[model samples]
Target: MKSLRTLRQAAAIVPIAMGRGKGRSRQALAERLGPLRGASTKVAQLLSARDGEDAGRALEPLPLARLLPVMRAAAPTLLGDGATIGAQGRRASLGQVHRAELSDGRDAAVKVLLPGVESDLRSDLGLMGWVGRRAGRRLRQRFDGVAVDDWIAALGDELLAELDYRAEAEAQGRYGRAVSSLPHAVVPAVIVAGDEVLISTWEGGSALADAVAWEPDKRAQLGEALTGAILHPMLTDGLVHGDLHPGNVAFREDRGGEIVLYDFGATREISLPARQAWRALLRGEVPAWDALLTLGFDAERLAPLRDRLDALAALLFAPFRERNATQIDGAERRARADALLGEHRMVPRLAAPTSAIPMIRTLSGLFTILGHLAAPMELWRVFDGADAPAPALPTRAPGKHVAPALPARLLVRSFGEDGRGVEIRLPFETLPDLEDLLPDSAREPIERSGVDLGALAREAFARGPIPQTLFDDVVEGRRVELRVIEA
Candidate 1:
């Protein structure tokens, strides 16, 4: 249900902040946002994994018309004197992309941040950290691993970088230079940049949405191109376009399919060892227990989830495996992942390898894109042809699965601590503000069915010491530092 406070807040901004364009009215899109919940942290970090994207897998652009005033105010800063806004424009995540007629006559897309968005972002991240850290602290009493506060702070920083336009321009420039070999992808050219504004040559071609209607081969080509663009940069150059959802990529048919990436604000850089680990994993070499530790696992806490390691490895890399999946293809994969995770049975753990977070985040986003594109193909083939030597990864024997306890024992020795040696009846509290997590869609169904949906949601998410199995899926996610605390 829309809160009275929220509805009033919407009334104040919708007219002032939304603008209609040639296509969708910006106000309509805002309404679609469903009760302007405290600034849409749903922006999901471009570099970020939503507040719970890693934990539970979790918006729209503001209008361009009403936004022109702010755009004009920042215009001279980005496009120079006499440069004014053009009528036709659209929205990008967290900002509006306006058509700008520069003083020099170059047409560009000018991006401007809405005032106060930064505060809202901080608030959302704070809430997430408060909740996640509490859960993390409990896990730590029994499990050793990534400090939830640190991971939250790192992610918060990554998301915060998107608010700075200048940082984006730098990332854009570097990415454009790095992808010279990815013939199918187009990285935007930075025209002029400012702390709050970014001006770039506008890109055109059908969006990935439009291409969904195209032939499967065309879609497959697009999927392949995008995967290569993302992988090449991260694996070879250590830079990655952290956001690659269908909305962020555009497709044009000059040859098979040319993919264009927009919104560089959320770029993430990967470390070399992390890249090598990914290469090794792809060849079926699950990293040694130590490698997993470096990648972000808390050994003592992670011991119980040993079998799920294969599931975690597969989840981190898929969206391509399984007969080359497309948007429509993840159910089988998700089911497989769910089975491996056994989220309901396993104690919750969040053991993310510190260095590999970006790659994990990218994969999370990539899996979502493949689900949207719904195009299937053999993803392993994409890497096999590369010069990166294919090390013969140790594969598991037919049906027998076993835990690497020796390595776990060794890891504990190396670290010299056994997590929490004593149990003091660690207390847990209910999830703060369970009301905040409710989905708008639930209300209508409740009204129609006379069901107590709010009660149901609260029942499931009511906070306290989070169940060890409560967020096991997130624990398995490479982006989150996780561990299993056997009760």
Candidate 2:
């Protein structure tokens, strides 16, 4: 067993200082340890060494022994008597999740902060503020006409606010209620306590791989449901889930085809403009050229971004795009993302920007999972439609066994210029069937429906025209297709 002293020491080495560029520092720290054989072992030794006086001094406001008592007191309120505490897992940017049980005698989850975490967070924010000011001065040339200080300050404030479990609990409740009307979606109930501890219900479901292997159509359905329940709130409601990765979502059998969302510590409220950008991208309404320009991304980098976004879109829409629903597995999807990010040195870039970490992590995980499921591009139709309601789970019909049709030809067309078109395809067979896709609850009216493919195609063409000569040929027998003319 790892000693508490060692854990404390290891935690101390984490360098809680703000604005020091967490990405860069972590890399440098990793490199520094390379020359030392068994570096981790040595670090563990130092951490475990019993130096109670020193540890207490370093810990300052909070002591280690006090942690268990604090946790015990808070656990009952959050988890109730049915809850049993488990070993602490790794600490994340927000808090740690421990396996537990509910008062009602069901398995559950609990989140608690490290001793003095609140105070440490406050100090970290102050440091970040100072660092942000300095960085703003140095990067003035690069970020001309932008409010660097304000951006940095906002980031620090965001970090501080995130440390508050109470705030997160409130946000979770608000978001949960917003999507409560939608079926096939689950947001765990938030258990509130004084400022530090949080407890929530835990839902059990199969892994993505298992789901896809069992049913492809259901996998696609899950994708659509997730976008509406989670993504919609983030894009239209100005309340970002902040963490939309697969780990944060679980598949439960009892809920029918609904997804169970876990972890709410990193939830952030976005602005109207950010939401607009999100909506435009999801609908394929934002032209590639415009997206690059708006985000201030370099044109040279557009190819990679376009490729990734297209692939991700297809994955998100797997059910509607791919006929068989079979594609690459989770491992392959991860490898593809890793390769792409590696080629672009995205990891290094990710490390340099602290504020972008959550966003990048979320995007990376989301894209990877989508790719694994081989989701289709058509689901974007659902994402972009402001008024579309969630789809109603079809009632089981007598002897019902209808095979899904191949994706519409028009929906498969590329978005690029004449001759050089980007193919949009999703791997559908790799995902779980529709029956296993969503969590079951009393059926609710579909808050949103599928996308209007015809309107979407027209909009895509309007943003970036294909050659007029190629238009008639592509549009033949298709409800929507690229209309291009030869020069």
Candidate 3:
């Protein structure tokens, strides 16, 4: 039975089993749960799907034939008794998408979650979350200065949200309003929806990635459209389309070929100040230090490293500086990336303002679309509003002292004999007391010398309020296998 307790139990066991060397236990449990509705079957389905492998070999996709029955039973109950199925098609993801047309001739796309998918996803995410935390901890150990949990949790949230069409409808509305000013862009309008079923106006366009074979000028136009539709929104408005991989975007040559954007599930928005700081930083200026400080940096940590932060900022933004539009070959970009990573290991904390995590994902996702098109556009030029030409890298040495970017959530997950011993969650706003972030079990070891918690926070955080260093030590300082999760 699908009870709250069952879901919670799955959530509890999965990560704990993963944290310990209980891979066998996790795998066995996943297997045992296979017969249950929406059980662990989806774990391998998503994995293989993303990897571009034979995903059906891992988990069978519901063929168009089988989709109708599931849709038939669920649609009337979900949409209404008057709803009728008009059209059906296979969505790119592992489910059938049906067009529900009413007697009134209104049409919409309805996606019903495959049987047992929600439960399967929960288990998969729990185990996958453990792996992500482990990876984050390992990366931290190497001083790579990245938090894996932040991205992973964001990812989990996005995937789960996709199951709810109502959320997607709201996001589509938000995106439509956000980019309403862009010339010749189309965002589908959502008509109505239940938890799993969405009814919206159908959208049609050529896949943006499919346009790679188009003429250079046409592809370039599409690239610019992609930028206006996807990139500029983040910089100017902070609202963003998080999943911009090739398939999610398209172009239409029919009506003057407007860039068509869809799949509004994985959406994110950055703060205004963070966006402003990014613009300043990309323009080869000192990123708005005040904005950076507002993000939560202590003056003490920032004072010693401002110049280096700028230097590192220069290196990170180097790739975007080349605005030739067509001059960059893949090899050269790779070389520059390698050189920067080799000569100076730029800290991740210094790369962007902390609140820009969504922006960070959006920017990286843009390049991924570019790589698919092999149509790398002059993104940097957009910032300068220039036409003559731009340099390959910053004309000056880089400098910027970035305090460790504060996490959205601070999680101290216990890795005791229970594996799921206990956790302390400190949202950024409530982190007034560093001691409060730890379990009673952790305070004794942390306050060993009666070190002033606030002073240590000021020294380590030098930004706003998190002493992630102290938190990191609490998780890592122990020789045991404790895991620290950055919220």
Candidate 4:
């Protein structure tokens, strides 16, 4: 029966995955996945969160009709007499929350797993495992050392654990107690826990989306609170809140502007050594190769690219390395990351430790939240909890080679009469291969336009890797613009 359900769900998803256009298909996929309410929905949320898509934002709470029975069935056992579960509240991939009045007259938030969601999650994971095996094979051709199976299993384990509200309640308790020292941080106290339901103190706050209207000072305070709330526990105790989204956080201006955190189903623990090494990396010190290996890279696989470790580490930890109060540019970050991967064709070679996957997810969620808050944050200060200055860009210790910063990119964009066009972005390191890399159609036109590709590249290199327009011309009825950009 589970297999049949998995098949049916997979069948339903095929059209959306194989849809015709990127924009329409993504919207269709998001719309389709939002209501599924299982691990599948989480896939959409995580991907969209990373890419800055609105898919996760569009998730609608389950209608009360679908959730009320589950709450009522569990209410007697969990809440006891005189308690009442109220209207449907926020929705998550695995559960939905409702406001309630407990028997003791205390307002509470009741979180319950969606009906049959456990089975749904198992089935979805089985399907994902099959997909991962197929993808793993293709990936192996490119990256012989990538541990795809381990990654998929780790993800499956995290998602499945969320169905156990008993565990989530405990995780919330731990996180709550850990963050108690932060005055502006709030984690609702768990009132009761059952197999599928957890009731906690009902927190009152406006949605995180409401922060846009706040004064700059208020937003900065909120950013500091959020950073402290997330980092303090992770750094001090190695306990991490792995699932964070706008819906999972709230801002309470009424309560002296508390940052209310929710949904502890997905969490992780980092080893103390790993935490220390990561701290050093964040502080702009390059750790020893053994220390870096402990942070989840596959040692043998990383050896081939060891020469570029400083640059890779710097790029990966860019958020922490920056000293200024600035908002991260996700697109630029992505472009640089993509260029790095392309430069080394390192996608397959680079293996993330299974344990680090959740940490990566946790960081992705944090970055997303901080991005939306859009306040000038001295992130290092927030991380250090002091007026510590940002360390200089990472440099190798004496006698060790330091890889230069990742190169800037050259972007070539062309539009036809009907506005259809292609944009090619190449890392500056690829400049020597410019003619070979360009398609014949693009190459022919540029050559005919009397622009010497080799000379142009040499001139750009002579001036150093900086942003400048190299070529902008109308050739053979095509409007083409080529420029250097720092990614």
Candidate 5:
């Protein structure tokens, strides 16, 4: 009986329905054959899993035959020439991509929504919200924190938006227009119908990992350009590429060594304050908790939370800072990052959680890629010196907004008598220029007099093993620090 049912359902999905029987329901038969619905349900469950072990398990790939029929049915005109399907790469619950040659002799990629994904996502998002709320309540009980209901609500909203390809098309168009003038950055065109189907010009290049493996220098240059493109819009324009992942970025050799960016389904508009926070990070300036309060963060509420952020950042950057004397090997850096990620899989639940997760993941992935390619830390200097060009806002007054001015002096201080170092301190204003501090060469510089201490620290600190003697303190809003340890 089961075998007969399976065969009947498969036949219905094919070019022709083969078997006919009395009292058989087409809807029930179709459901049996349509893996899309099953797969989407599974994906939603995985995504909503409270723990990584439950979430990271992979799902089975759906057959192309089932999807092709749906695509052809929706856009007969586009696929009238009998679409020749190529390789199907990397199947996730959301969708799968195919590399194909269009009948018109153009190389393109087609993305098809998995069967029942839309409906499954809707159900899954609701479940996740419930789980998130429950989790938040538990945390609040244990830690005396408020439930992150707003955050969960924001995530639910974004997830729903992502399920709609039509909305994504509009977003992609907006981003394309914004970065249109920029060189070496590409956003693919989308083709939409009743069911959202996207057709984009195929971007061919080595995966970033492979590119870095082939030529380290080229990887470094690419990393710089990619970082500039990713960060500039966020800091200067208040627009962020919400979904930046290794899979989303492609490297093309022909376009003057360009990095092609794809998938605008998760794009987001950042607030001005968040943009400023990002800029501060790029400049290596850690603003005070009070400053964040001024920008609308609840200081009393976030003071303890800020400590955790500091700890996480320190943990993340420790290798770069403490091991300054040693070379940051790309493979080793990735391994370390993976280990760190493994140690803590749960991200801070915040409003717009989806946006936050992707951005955080992207930052980590980009930095890891850079480290793997041996890209000089100096490449990050672009954000520090000579302000980056901000994205023009259609509504905002021109020239009314300017970047916050850099502080005049940066100071570093060290604490402890002579041998046992207690702490290192740095004043906010005294943060050294990020570009100048990054090591261009593997060799360390020798100490000399009449040299700017900040420059000396930049070179000396580039090599690993931060000295215990160095410490930093702030004075009159200027950056001040004392060094107890030498790297």
Candidate 6:
């Protein structure tokens, strides 16, 4: 029954993804994945960090009456006598957490896994695997067949790992001890663990989402704590809390803004080599192609571009390489990347490594948390030296660095055969949509001149929007100028 329901949900997502825009498709997929409640929903939740949607927001907690019996059964000894389990306080991907008061008068959070969730998740992954292969074959231009299999396999391993409560307890205990020196990081201690139930000391704090609206100084302080909480474990011990979403992490004003981390079920251990490569990438010391290799991209396919790889690397990683750079323009970077991949048609040649998927997922979640805080962090402080541990918060508040102001409009000027000047002005924001907005008459001439207006616009936008000529040359015997205007 579970497999059949997942099948229906999976099938429904296909048409929605094909018929709608990217944002709408993401919303539709999240809506469908929410109900499946296992590996399917886990993937949705991970992607929510990028899509700016709370995929798990709609998840309904299993009723206490339905879950209490399972908790008692899983840990009969722990639930016996004066221990009283209260209502469900949190709903997770695979389980629901309830507040419990033990006979010893200690407060605890009892997390009870839904019955047969492991088997159901396995079934869901199997079905999704089948779907992935079928879709990969049809969409051979965009997805590599083998890479698709590897990615799904990698995701399956990480998702299944979250089902083991014993493993979670161990990871949580290790992480708690690892961050003990950082007074601002709070990792709740594990009290007891059963096969399917994990009991930990009850923790109190407001969600990180709420912290976003606090004063700038407080938000910056919380951001520093969050950065430490996520980076320390990964850099020092290579153990990462895979799900650091706002719901899983909180802020305690009473505790002097300590970051309260919860939900350790998705923790992962990073390998030494992978950790070193990530540090190099973050420090902007390594080439883009090297980072790609670490990420499991196809070296053979990338070989053809070796002659100009450095130039390509500079274009791709300029934002990271520059020290004290304030803004990271992800959109423009993506557009240029799409152009490169489109021109080369190398999307299908890529490969996804099993070991790297979780690391990437961990970083994606961390950046999302940082984005929410929306404050300038002295990120370089995290790696002041080659082997530095996560450093103490800087004595000074985060510095304010202003980016160059964006241009208001784009001006396209051309001279007609009669020596008349013709001009077209477009809103600055429409630069990204330049490809679609151009008519055949104008686009054909630009294409003939071997100039890709879309890529040019993206690169210009990324270089910081100021008064600059985007394109200037003769197109079909007519002098043309395309530039962004400050006004």
Task: Show pairs that collide, candidate 6.
Answer: none
- Pitting candidate 5 against candidate 6, the one with the higher lDDT is 6
Question: Considering lDDT, which of the candidate structures 3 and 6 is the better prediction for this target?
Answer: 6
Question: By TM-score, how accurate is candidate 5?
Answer: 0.57
Between candidates 2 and 3, the one scoring higher on lDDT is 3
Q: Write the per-residue lDDT of candidate 4 for residues 137-204, one digit (tens) a residue.
A: 54656564124444554576678777888888889999999899889999999987888778899987
Question: Can you write out model 2's per-residue Cα lDDT over 297-408, one digit (the tens) per residue?
Answer: 3233344455565555444334333445545565665566566555553423321222333544455455555655555433444444553432222111111121233333
Worst lDDT 10-window in candidate 5: 394-403
Query: Candidate 1: global Cα-lDDT?
Result: 0.54
- TM-score preference between candidates 1 and 2, better one: 1
Number of clashes recorded per candidate: 29, 56, 26, 1, 49, 0
Rank order by lDDT, top first? 4, 6, 1, 3, 5, 2
Per residue, candidate 3 scores C-alpha lDDT tens digits across 202-299 of 77777544576777766666666677677566666667786555446667765655787877766766655545555555565445344344333333
TM-score of each: 0.64, 0.49, 0.60, 0.71, 0.57, 0.71
lDDT for each residue of candidate 5 in 132-155, tens digit (9 for 90 to 100): 444455454543232153343344
Poorest stretch of ten by lDDT in candidate 6: 393-402
Provide the lDDT at 220 for model 5: 55
Top-lDDT candidate index: 4
Give the clash count for model 1.
29
Off by over 4 Å in 6: 1-4, 17-23, 51-53, 138-143, 291-297, 301-323, 329-349, 385-487
| Candidates' C-alpha lDDT | 0.54, 0.46, 0.51, 0.65, 0.47, 0.64
